[model samples]
Target: MGDTTIAPPPTAQRRAGVWQAVLLLAGSCMPVLGSVLITPILPQLSEHFGDTPGAEVLVPMIVAIPALMIALFAPFAGQIVDRLGRKTLLVVAMFAYAIVGTAPAWLEALPAILLSRVLVGVCEAAIMTVCTTLIVDYFHEERRRNRYLGLQTVVTTLAATAFIAIGGALGVGGWHTPFWVYAVSILIGALMVISLWEPTAAEAGEPEARDRPAKVRIPWARIGVPLLVTLFGGFTFYVIVLEVSYLVVGTGVAADDTATIGGVAAIASLATAIGGLSFAKLSKLGHGVLLPLAFGLQAVGMLVIWIVPGLPGIGVGAVIASFGSGVLLPSLLTWVVAAAHFADRGRVTGWWTSAFFLGQFLTPILVAVLAAGLGALPAAVGVVGIVALLVGAAVGFALRKASAAVAA
Candidate 1:
C-alpha cells in the first residue's frame, strides 16, 4: 500500500497563509474605495462641472455609478471567474481599475468623467467578485472562512471611514488629488501578482475534478432564501451608514458642525468594525441565534432613534444598528456560501454580490419613499427597523421548526 501511494501535485498541496489573506483582504477594499473615496470631493466635482447640463444629477452619479455597475456586472464577473479562472480576471480588473479610477484627474468634460466612473464600476465588478471568490477558495475550513468573511466586513467598513477622511483631505488640493488615490490599486495588483497563485481543483476538494462536467449548475434552491435575506440585509446595513449624517443634523446638530457630525459617524463606524470582529467568535452560535440577535439589535437601535429623541438617541441608536449590520453582513455571507461547490462558487458569490449591492443602491430611494410617506426620515427608518424585527422573528421561528423536525 505504501509503495502504491501517490503524492499530490505541488499546486494541489499549496496552502494560503497570512500573505494571501492580506492581499485578498486589501483587494476586497477596492469596491469600497470606488464607492466612497469620491464622496467627500463631490462638492468640488460639482463646482468644477457646475456649468455642465444636469451637473447636479450627474455629479452625484459619479459617486453612485460604481455601485450600480457592481450590482449590474458582478454576476457576469462571477461567470468569468468560474469559467475563466479567478486570479487572472482579478489581476486584470485591478489594473483596469487603476487606469479608469485616475482618469477623472485629467478629464475636462463632465460626461467624460462620468464615463470614466462607469468604467471604474466595471472594473470594480470584477475586482469584488474575484476577491470574494478567492477568499472562499483559499480558506475552506469553516472557522477560517467565517473569520475572513467577518474581517472582510470589518476591513471594508473601516476603510470606508478612512477613505472619506482621505478624500476630504485630498480635496483641499482639488478634486483631482483624490482621483490619484485610485492608483493604489496598481500597487495592490502588483503585489498580488507576486504573492498569489490560482487554487487548483484538487485544492477545492475535487481531486477527481477532471472527470466532472465542465459546468456545474448553481444550487439555487439552497441559496435562494439566503440571497433574499441578503438583499434586505444589504438595505438595512446601509440605512445607518447613509443616514447618520442626516440623522445627526435632524438631532439639531448644525450640518456645518463637521466636527460633531464626523465624530458621531466615526463612532458608529467603529461600532460596525467591532461587530464584524465579534462575529468570528459569535458565529459559533450558528445563524439561528446570530441572525435574530443581529436584526433585533438593529431594530432596537432604530426604534431608539425613532422614540428616544435628539443626538444622544441618534448616536446610541446608530451605533447599535451599525453593529447589528456588521454581524448581519457576514452571517448572510456565510449562510449563502456554506453550500456552494467549487464549480459554481464563483457564480454563487456573484449573485450574492449583486443582491447585496443592489440593496445598497436602492437604500436611499427606498428610505426617501418611506420618508415621504411617513413625513419624517427617522420615522421611515423606524418602519424599516420594525420590518427587520419581524423578519428576524420569522427566521428564528422557521429555524426552530426545522430543528424540531430534524430532532424528531
Candidate 2:
C-alpha cells in the first residue's frame, strides 16, 4: 500500500569489484545486441534468399525471432538463476551464445540459420537475467543501484547502435560477417569466470547466509503494476527502435537509402544514451516525477515527427523520443527492484524482462494494425504517442499516491 523500497545508506557496503561490474555491463548488452545487429542487413538477406521457400517471412524472422525467444525463455532463465546460481549459468550461456550466434556465418541454409538464431535467443535469456540479477545483488543502496541501472541502459543503447552500424558495414562483406560479433561474448565470458563471484547474502553482511535456494513468497501484487506498465513501456520504447528507419524511409527524404537512414538511427540512439547518462542525477527526482516527464517527452516527440516537414524535423523528434525511452527503462527497473524482496529478485526480474521483450516483439504487429486504421505510419506513431502520454499521467498519479501514503 506504501513505498516498500529499502534505501540503504551510501556506506551500506563496499563497492562491487570493477571487473564484476564490467562483465555484467558487457553481458547486459547481449539482449539488445541480437535484436538490432542483423537489422541493417535484413533487406540484403531477403534479396539473397529470395529464391528460398517462405523467404519473405523467414528472412525477416531472423531479425525478430531472438526477441520472441527471449520473451518466452527469460522466466525459465530466471528460475535457473534462482536455483542454480548466477555465475555458472551466465558463463555457459555466453559461450553457447557465441556458437549459436555465429552459426549463420558458414551455414547456407535459411532454416538452419533461423534455428541458430532461436538458440542464440535462448542463451540470451539466461545471459540477460543473470546479468541483471547479479547487478541487484552487487548494489544494495538504492542510489548506487539506480546509477548502475542507468549506466547499464547507456551501455545497451550505445552497444545496440554500434552493432547496427557494424552489421551495416559488414553486410558489404556479407551478411555472415556480422554474426562474428557474437563471438565477442566468448571473450566476455572468459573474463566473467575470472572476475565474477557467486554473490550471497553472507558477503553483503549476513555471515550465516548460504548460497542455498530458499522458497520465498513473491510479492506479486506489489510487482503487478510495475510489470504491467513495463509491458506498455516496452512497446513504446521500441516503436522508434523498430520503426525509425522505416519512418525515415517512408518520409521519402532518405530516398530508400539505407546508409542515410542508418545514420539517423545512430544519432537517435546516441541521444538516448546521452539521456541515460543523466539518469544518476535525475534519479533524485523520483519516479513519480520522472515517469510523467519521460512519457510526455516521448508523446510530444512522436507527434513532432508525425507532422514535421523534413529529415531534420524527424531527427529532432527521434532524439526527443529516444531521450524519453532512455530514461524510462532505469526508472521502471529501479522501481521494480526496490519493491521486490532480495530473495525473489531473480524471478521478479525475469518476469519483468519477459514482459518488456514480449511488448517489444509485439510492437510491429500493434503498429501495423494501428497504421491500417490510421491510414499512415506516422499517424499510427502519433496515436501511440497519445496513448503513452495517458499512460504516463496515470502512472504519475499512482506513484504520487504511493509516495504520499509513504509520507503520511
Candidate 3:
C-alpha cells in the first residue's frame, strides 16, 4: 500500500519566538503574584483588622483566597479559553487582574478587601489557564515545549522569592503599599496585547483525523492518573515552601529571626530553581524515569529532615526535596498536556491547574491534621515522604511493566 501520511497545511506553520514565550511566561506569573505578594503583609492586615469579627480567620484568607479560586474556577476558565479563544481571555484577565489585585490598596473595609481578593483569584484562574494553554499551543514541538515548561517552573519559583522581598519592602509603608505591586500586570498585559496572537487550529497543528465532526472529549482515561498524581505532587511540592519557616523555628531558631528562616528558605528555593533548569536536558529520559526519580529524591529529602536533628537536617532536607519538586512540576505538566490536541488542550491545562492548586490549598490543612495526629510537624512531613516513596516505587514498577508488555 502507498504511504498516506499528510503534512500539516502551510497555515499551520505559525512560529512563536522568544518574545512571545517571554510574554506568556510573564503572564504565568500573574497567579504567583496573587499568591505571594500579600503574604509578607498578612500580619499587618491582621493588626489593622484586629477588632473586626473573625479577623483572625479572614485576614489570612486574603492571601489564600486566590489559590482556592484557581482550584474552583480554572476549569471554567479553560472552557472559556477552548471556546472563546486563548489570547482574548488572557489579555482581558491580565488587565482585570491588575484592577482587582490593586483594589485593596484603596479599599477601606476588610470585607471589601476580601471581596477584591476573590476577584483577584477569579482573574488568576483565567490568567494561569490561558498562559499555560498558550505556551503549549505556541510551542508544540516536544523539545521546545519541554524547555519552556521547565523554564516556567524556574521563573515562577524565583519570582516567588522576589515578590516576597518586594512585599516586605512595600509593607514598610503599610499593608496597602504592597498592593501597588499588582499594577505591574498592567504593563505585562499591554506588552502581551502587542506581542501575542490568537493561535488558529491550523497553527496548533490539529491532526487530520481530529477534523471530523465527532464531538471532542477530554482524554480523561489518558490524563486521569497524571492529574491524580499531580494532586499529591502539589501537596508535597508546597511542603517546604509553606512549612520551612515553622520547621526552622521548631529547631530552636527564633521565630523573629527572619534572617535564619529566610536564608534557609532561600537556599531551598535556589535548589528548586536549579532542578527546574535541569529538567529540559533531563526530560529526554521520559516521565517513566523522571517522575519516579523526582519522587524518590523528595522522599529521601523529607526522611533526612525527620531523622537528622536540628538546623542542618532541616536545611539540607529542604533543599533536596525542593529540587525534586522543581523537577516534578514540569514533568507532571508535560505528561498531561503532551498528547492533547488543539481542541482539548485548554481544558487539559485547566484541569491540571485545578488539580495542582487544589493540592496546594489542601497542603497546609492536611499537614496540620497530620501534625496533630503525630504530635510533631517533622513526623508528619516524614509520613508524607514515606507515601511519596511508595508512590514512586509503584509508578516505576508500573511503567516498567507497561514497557515490558509493549516490547513483548
Candidate 4:
C-alpha cells in the first residue's frame, strides 16, 4: 500500500517573531520616508533650478518618476523575489536607497535630480515588493494578516508624519538635511541580512497553495473594484501631498511662511496616522460599506474645505477624509485579497498596482493643469471629487459582481 501520512499544520503564526517584525517594518518604511522627505524640499528645489517652466515641471517629475517607475517595475521585482527571497532584496534595495536616494541634491541640474528619482524608484520597487512578500511568509491566519496590513498602513503613516517634521526642520537649515533620513535604510539593509531568518517551506508552513488574486491578472471585477478604491484613495492623498501648501497659500494663509505651512502638512498627515491606527474597530463591517463611506467622507471633507477655506476647516476636513481612508483601504484590500489564490495574486494586483500608482503620478499633473486655469488649488480639489464619486460606484458594483461570480 502507498504510504499514508498527513502532517498536522503548526499552530504558530507564519510571521517572524516581534524583533524581526520590527526590523522588517522599518525596512518597509524606507520607501515611504524617502518619498515624504522630499516634499518639504520641493519648493527649495524649484528655486534651485532657477525660474523656468521646464524646471518647474522638473520638480513634479522628480517626485513622479519614482512612483511611475515603481509601478512599471513591480512585476519584475516579483519574478526575482522568488529566487532571492525577501531579505536579500530588502538588504540590497535598502542599501541602494541610502546611497542613491540622496544623489540628486549633490548634483546640479534638473536632469540629475530626475535621474536620481528614477533610481530611487527602482530601489523602492524592490523594498516594497519584498517586504510585502515577507509578511505573507511570516503570517498564517487570515484575520492576523488583515490586522498586519492595518499595522503596515499605520507604520507608513507614522513614518510620513515623523519625517515631515524632521524634514521640514532640516530643510530650514538647507534643502539637503532632509535627505539625510535616507541613510536610515543602510541599517535596515544590514539588519535584513543578519537578523531576518529564512524558514524552510515546511517550517514556514506557507501551505500547499496561497490565495492572492494579483498574479498575471484576475477577474476584471476583482481588479476593477480594488483598483477604483486605490485610485480614489490616491487622488485624495494627492490633495495633501502636492497641493496642501498651495491650498494654504491660495486660501490666503501664510503661504510664504515655511514653518506654518510645514506644520499644517504635518497636521494633515497626523490625521492619517490616527485614522490608520483606529481602523481596527471597523474591520468587521467588511469592504462593501467601508469603501464608499471612506470615499464619501473624504470627498465631503474636501468640499467643506473648498467652501470654507481656513486651517481649522482644513484640519477638520483632513481628519474626516483620513479616517475614511484608514477604514476603507485595509478593509477592501483584505476582503478581496483574502479570496485570491497566491499564484494569481501578484498578476491580478499588477493591474491594481498599476492603476493606483498611475493615479499617484497623474494627480499632481492633472491638478496643476486644472489649477492653471481654475485660478487656485482649492478649485482643483473640488473638481476631483467627481472622479471619487465614480470610484465609489465602481466599488459597489464590484462587490456585487464578485459575490455573484463566486456563488455561481
RMSD to true structure for each model, in Å: 2.2, 6.2, 3.4, 3.9
Q: Which stretches of candidate 4 lie over 4 Å from their true place?
A: 1-15, 51-53, 82-84, 198-206, 210-221, 335-338, 344-352, 372-376, 404-408
Q: lDDT score of model 2?
A: 0.86
Query: How are the candidates ranked when ordered by lDDT, highest leading?
Result: 3, 1, 2, 4
- Which 10 consecutive positions of candidate 2 have the poorest summed lDDT? 203-212
User: Compared with the true structure, what per-residue lDDT tens digits does model 4 show for residues 119-193?
Assistant: 898888777766765555565455566667677777887787787768878899887667767887877778778
Tally clashes: model 3: 0
Which tens-of-lDDT digit does each residue in 1-408 have in candidate 3? 898999876553568989999999888888898989888888888889999999999998888889999999999998898788898999899889889999999998999998999999899999999989988888888889999999999999999999999999999998889999899999999999988999876666665735655447888988898889989999999998999999999999999999999999999999999999999999999888999999999999999999999999999999999999999999989988867888888899999999999999999999999999999999999999999999988887877888889999
Each model's backbone clash number: 0, 0, 0, 25
* Candidate number with the higher TM-score (3 or 4): 3
Which candidate number has the best lDDT?
3
Candidate 1 residues 245-307, lDDT tens each? 999999888978999999999999999999999999999998888999999999999999999
Whole-model Cα lDDT per candidate?
A: 0.90, 0.86, 0.91, 0.67
Give the TM-score comparing model 4 with the true structure, all chains together: 0.84
lDDT of 1: 0.90
Better of 2 and 4 by lDDT: 2
In candidate 1, position 135 carries an lDDT of 86
* Candidate 2: tens digits of C-alpha lDDT, residues 161-227: 7887788788898878888989999999999988787876654334444553587766788988899
